[model samples]
Target: MLAFYPRFIRTFDDLPGQLSLLIHAWNGCNMRCYGCHNADELIAKPPKDHLSGAQVVERLSGYDAMFDAVLFSGGEF
Candidate 1:
């Protein structure tokens, strides 16, 4: 129910292709698979103030034309 844009992409000078926005949906995951890089953080409780889906869309409205796709990430449970 929450998402965040964690990357700061200022330009496409050194990029290879069209850009995609990565939305970190930190809603907590319990999988805890071995070798998982985000195991510790994802297992912890998420904050109550995280932005809703609507809020995320509204906040990124101005930059609509910047990216070609929106990639929802994080959370495995």
Candidate 2:
């Protein structure tokens, strides 16, 4: 079986009341919609450093106790 990996460019909304993590899955996007911040990152394929599903779970597992929920954004599946 293949190994799992997870990568996030950065996180936001790290306030005391709301503990949320913004996860960036793939940089490769099929659509070129307007007002897109990750336009540059989108390509034919996501970078090798891109995170995987299992990796994401592991990263967020630690925050499960502190955070209410994880918000996944950037790049469409």
RMSD of candidates 1 onward, in order: 4.8, 4.5
- Scored by CA lDDT, what does every candidate get? 0.58, 0.56
* Maximum-TM-score candidate: 2
Q: Note the residue pairs that clash in candidate 1.
A: none
Candidate 1 lDDT over 1-77, as tens digits, reads 44543332343333447576656665555455678654554445445556767877777889878787666656552
lDDT score of residue 18 within candidate 1: 58
Worst 10 residues of 2 by lDDT: 1-10
Models 1 onward score TM values of: 0.55, 0.57
Question: Which parts of model 2 are misplaced by more than 4 Å?
Answer: 1-17, 41-46
lDDT of 2 at 28: 46
